[model samples]
Target chain A: MAEMYSTPHEILYYEADVTGKLSLPMIFNLVVLSSTKQSVDLGVGPKFTHENGVGWIILQEDMKINRRPVDGEQVILQTMAKEFNPFFAKRLYRILDQAGNVLVDVDAFYTMVDMEKRKVARIPQAMVDAYQADQVKRIPRLAEPTKFEEGMEADQVQEYAVRFSDIDSNQHVNNSKYPDWMQDVLGADFITSHEPTAVNIKYEQEVRLGEYVRSEVKIVGNTTLHQIWANGTLSAEAEITWTEL
Target chain B: MAEMYSTPHEILYYEADVTGKLSLPMIFNLVVLSSTKQSVDLGVGPKFTHENGVGWIILQEDMKINRRPVDGEQVILQTMAKEFNPFFAKRLYRILDQAGNVLVDVDAFYTMVDMEKRKVARIPQAMVDAYQADQVKRIPRLAEPTKFEEGMEADQVQEYAVRFSDIDSNQHVNNSKYPDWMQDVLGADFITSHEPTAVNIKYEQEVRLGEYVRSEVKIVGNTTLHQIWANGTLSAEAEITWTEL
Candidate 1:
């Protein structure tokens, strides 16, 4: 089995909101950071991907936030590769406070893709062997995100021009940015009064640089449904449930 | 003399751009983080500000980027409290790669402000004493950012509504987010082709929640002039010089 990788991070001022708790988007960014660190440690990082002409693309992620650490608090982020199949890999993440109290848990699914062809590629046995990832016949599944219905009207629509800062090394918008678009569509007042308790996101298409993406948000009770469209195609969809603060 | 506080940071994938080099805004955020760490170490962090009902507000910052570090690279961020007078404090930052090569240098000025009144306040003598800040009477001054001429038309004017992600614990937009706005106004093509060599920003007013701030960009040769307006009043201005990559 692959060893769990843990990284310590201090909650910086920029990472926290007015309530002093870590923001959801920042938490997602930290998850990505920790995952990348684990890949580097497992010898499947950017260097390996660049050499092999293959890259890992996240397909879906679901996270439950039990508690949001505040600024100046030091927390540990631990991740482990659960299973790797022919085309998909599953990973789990746990975030703990200084006292080792679990603050958040996340499950992420990824697939190997050919960088040039942009098609799903088989996960090489050698790579999986290198990680010594757990071999599980049945991987636990997260709740599948529902797509926005055809011709469904949105309560609010917001437009964002993809900027240089939004694109990652893959020349596409970073997955962590999708939450920002969703949060922005909810506006400031709604966000300030409500705190996200859970989030589920499924990335369908890549958002390229210079693209103008539209985020459509539909609010039902405490849950917000988000659909992102670029060039008339749905790029991503997400569901976020919030608690009144 | 207070010993310089140095923090080690690994360049995460999210901090770097498509070129694998750290983005300018991320670099600035690192500087802020380092500075905050130093303040905490010196017993003048957020807790102190909360207790005293006063906080440091950055007035202006100037930075020179020598070399941008790439993802997975380990670097050291060092900061020093240079000087503190009655109203203002000066700080300096140096970012060095693992090889001890300086990657960037920055200087920033700040003043204490009453959180409730939102007006400048005198720097308490006890706080300065606690920091053990340098007593240099002649604090080095950064180049003053030239304000955009009144009634001058901009080449591009873009509006961005302040979102949940933009507001920090201070209930105002984080200073680092301003650069992203400026870069967004320039679009992806300009940023991908040019690298910023130097930046000088002066914050004149605070941007509140739900405000639609307009960023006006005027390009002249290698230098770009930026003005951010809210409610028809100039909130901030910046000057950035670029080098062709």
Candidate 2:
């Protein structure tokens, strides 16, 4: 079993929506940040990776939410390096309440990229040794997010100019922001009236700096499928399952 | 001296910009949040204010930055209720490193708003007593941010759509976002090339939910003045003095 690392977090007010629960994007960010914390603990964090001319990039994630934490709530994020292949790695993250009640569960996949060439690089042996990542011949694949239903029209489309704040230290749009761009098309009323139960997001291409992205959502009943288009290219796609609040 | 409250915070990656320093808006948010923590410690947090039919709204702030904290750094937010008159209260905030070196200092002014009436209200006695605020006869006025020079045109204008996530619990755009709209006009290169040494910002009106905002900026030498207009009404104004990186 891989060793686990845990970090304490407080849900800041700005992270919560009108429903008082952590916004979807913030939820994603917290989980991803937990993994980063784990990487830091393993001595394979951004500094180490960047020094070696490579950096980790998240390509996909699937998350299940038991309940969303509200504003000013204290939560524990637990993460571990699960397994990896020659080309990819898989990590697990769990957000728990003070009493150890699970609030969210996620399985995230990552790959290392060469900073200079912007190409996927082989998983470094030093990282594997540091994380004790189980060396598997092939990493298992997560289920693809479901596509839009037949004849489904775009329920709503929202345009956003990627602000400088949207960029992260990785010089790319952070993974958490994709959900905001996607779900924001649902509007304020819908956001307040429903809670997300499950979310699956896949990144096809990186959204660069200062690029305007159009987020389109097609709602078929309680499940909304979202696509973020940047200049006619699909940047990211997501599917969210929601239940009435 | 007013009662002081101190809280510890870790700088998250998202809060850091390309320059590896905390974003200007985030610095403002942190200091303001420090005051909120003080309020909570005094048992007059959002819950208490909401139940009492009143809320604290920041009207203006002036900040001086010795240095901006970098990501992954642990810092302490120190705040205290300073002085107040019948309608306005002035507070002081400091962000310090682990070694007790000050990174940023701010003076913030606030007023109570009657949520039901959507109007400024008298400062409640209970809060004043709880915080042990000195009842001063008047709050000293802050220096106004300088207006544009003669015949100066807007250096750049950027339009933004108010997203669902932009609205805070107060049902209006959060104060932190105003600096973002103001400074993003400087573009990514300028942001990375310079650091803000001083900032003075004031609010004239609130930007309601879903309202489009136009941010205009005029740069004179190293100082940039900004105005945020929502449908031809000035919502906020600011001036930032920048130093070369």
Candidate 3:
């Protein structure tokens, strides 16, 4: 069996939204935490990468929610290094209720970049052996972000000046903030009245310090196509499916 | 001894700022999580209060950091209901390093409000007993938020439209976001180079939905005073002391 890690997590109220459900940003944080812990256990943690003059980066992620965990609810978070290529790797994560019913499923793609050259680095064989995950020669396909229709105009546009605190350990805007910047533009009326059912994100560029990004959203029914633009470039694109509360 | 609760928290990458230390907001979140767990263990969690038609609120908080915990560091979070009056209570929390040295100390003031009447409610004696904490006849005095020097005009101001997810379970802006909105206006240069040594905050008014708030900051040497204004009223005020990194 491939190596796996799991932990019990209690959804703190501070992590919940006005609807008393786990917010999308926090859901992303918690699932990432699970994978991080797994890496640490496998002995290829951040420190390990830093010592090797490399850094981890996320390229894309897809999330499907059967049900968002609620405040004060205890759930089990599980993650494993599922598949890998010489250039990229995929991690599979799931949140399970007490009854073992999966509440959320996520597939995240990651690659290591050399700190000095800033180029994608080959996956180390020893690191893959630590996790007991399969090494594949082919790159795994990630779900494409929701596509925008021709001549479709954004229903709403909001801009956010990046916060100093927005810079995470990566020394750049954290991946979790992307979803917050994307969906929050939907306005309070739609946000508080709807729940996200699924989300797909593709990270194209990193947000720089002191840069203000504009978030534009096109809504049609329950599916919303979103984009985050920084420095006049499309930094990220996403699609989210929601259900009315 | 009062009924004390403690938990181990590993500072994750998402929780750290660019400085590699725990961000002010995440520190607040972790300490609050410890206290929340204590309340749940005492059988008086959010559910109990909701069923009793009441809600918990923070009036003020003061935090002093002897040293900030770094990324990937494991620290012990301890909290206990220290003192209480008929209407207010004080919870003392400490974050300790593995060597048992205190890294941060915080004292938070809290009171419950009647959900329907929307007024401060008297503390129930039975509830106090559960914590095995002291009850005082007089309201406990708290450290006032740092007083501003007269004629001090804010050097910088940033406006933020309240996000839909910024509202927590209370249906109001989360107290943690107040610090983020405040310090982020210091810009990337100050935030990446200076580390906060202490923070004092007083929450006066709650922010409303769809309202754009302005964050104002005045810096004099190592101290910065901050304010959050919504609807042309001071919603929150804070003072932070920093040390050059």
Candidate 4:
């Protein structure tokens, strides 16, 4: 497929993670925004979402981080549908550096929902047709995380109750807000002065309304990592390396 | 000089105005984030900021908005130093769409400060050398605001006391937090359901600690459109169009 449509964006400081590269949650949010625009350009913009009072809700996500891209590095994010069923759709994505080197790849699953009922619904034919028609060329699917690696238990752990402001467009705790779990574990002093050099994270599950997730941080020599889990299932995990300023 | 580096960002829903395009404050925040990174990559980064016990502060800004870019549209933001004087450094920036169309151009002055004394100070030699030597090319001088915009008048406008969370990394109001000013002007119901479309705003001045500024918003034509103003002077004037649903 031709480029069809493309938008540009600049990375900001708040968007940067430990490695001083953009954080995974931020990357996820961007994927969502870009995909929404692509949908609109395909004439599906806000039809089912606004007119029918329905929207896509991310039920699950499996992502892997190969390498961290530094702050101020220009890159492109492209999205296209991989497959769709009556209830769910699988989408593929790639993050590339300015020279077109693949930085990260993601495969996401989404379900349609009735906003008022807050229940999953069948995918609208019109919506699927819109994305399928505008589907950009697909990139290879991202590496999915293996079962939890041994010795991965956190070295330090902290907990936080979700605040009202933490919710995102979907009215759920934003995927990116999970990083605050790590930041809280690192404590204010460490974060205020030190910059993370790189970070790799995966969102295996999500923390829902009014619930608190424990953010655990582990140290292995110079590298510090963190993760959040609810009940026994992993929610998100991240590795951060800090440098003295 | 050749471009040393640039970063790509995807627009988020929270960043969008009612028009579904990104808002001026959101774009401004993007520039601030990019400029900070430029300073860092130039080797000035946060080293000089810490050494001086002060940080970069945006003193005044004058910007022009030609067109608005919608949410999910990737728009490249480019930044460069225009001139470095004794106490202040002038920077110029441009926001471009995929075809490299300029959506907005900004010219503003930033000053180094003594955080302890709350006073402006000359640019340190080390800082100047760091930015000048970096490969990001400098731009030509910029145009001044065409009209005479006044600073806030002491009385007559509605007043708001700043909140603790309002202070951002630099200890000032997180630039984006000001849009809540418009929300303050409207009833709660309008904000919960209606979405904002297009907005035009200018940051004429800054509000500091212990200072309260007045807010004024005027409805134009329909309740959906508003002309918002702050303080006696036009701290910022915005046109917000809302979408029901």
* Best model per lDDT: 2
By DockQ rank, best first, the candidates go 2, 3, 1, 4
Q: What TM-score quantifies how close candidate 3 is to the native fold?
A: 0.94
Best by TM-score: 2
Per-model RMSD to reference: 2.1, 1.5, 2.1, 10.2
Model 2 bad stretches (over 4 Å): A149-152, B149-152
Interface RMSD (Å) of candidate 4? 6.9
Model 1, B1-245: lDDT tens digits are: 76688999878777888788998778878998898887778788878887899988998989888888888889999998889888888988999998888899989999899999989887777778887887666666678976678688898888887777788888898888788888789877788899888889998898988788999999998899999999998888999989987
DockQ of 4: 0.09
Q: iRMS of every model, one decimal?
A: 1.7, 1.2, 1.5, 6.9
Q: Give the lDDT of residue B61 in candidate 3.
A: 87
What TM-score would chain B receive for each of the candidates shown? 0.95, 0.96, 0.95, 0.68
| Steric collisions counted per model | 0, 0, 0, 20
TM-score, prediction 2:
0.97
Worst 10 residues of 2 chain A by lDDT: A146-155
Candidate 4 per-residue C-alpha lDDT over B36-57 given as tens digits, one digit per residue, 9 for 90 to 100: 7777777777666877787777
Docking level for model 2: medium
For B1-245, candidate 2 gives per-residue lDDT tens digits of 57678999999877788666888889978887787777887888888899889988888888889999998999999998899887999898999999999999888888989999989999888888888889999889888888754346898989999987788888889898999887788898888888899999999899876789988899889999988889888888888999987
TM-score (all chains, Cα) for each model: 0.94, 0.97, 0.94, 0.54
> Can you write out model 3's per-residue Cα lDDT over A129-210, one digit (the tens) per residue?
8888888888658979867643578899998888777777777788888999987888877887888889999998889778
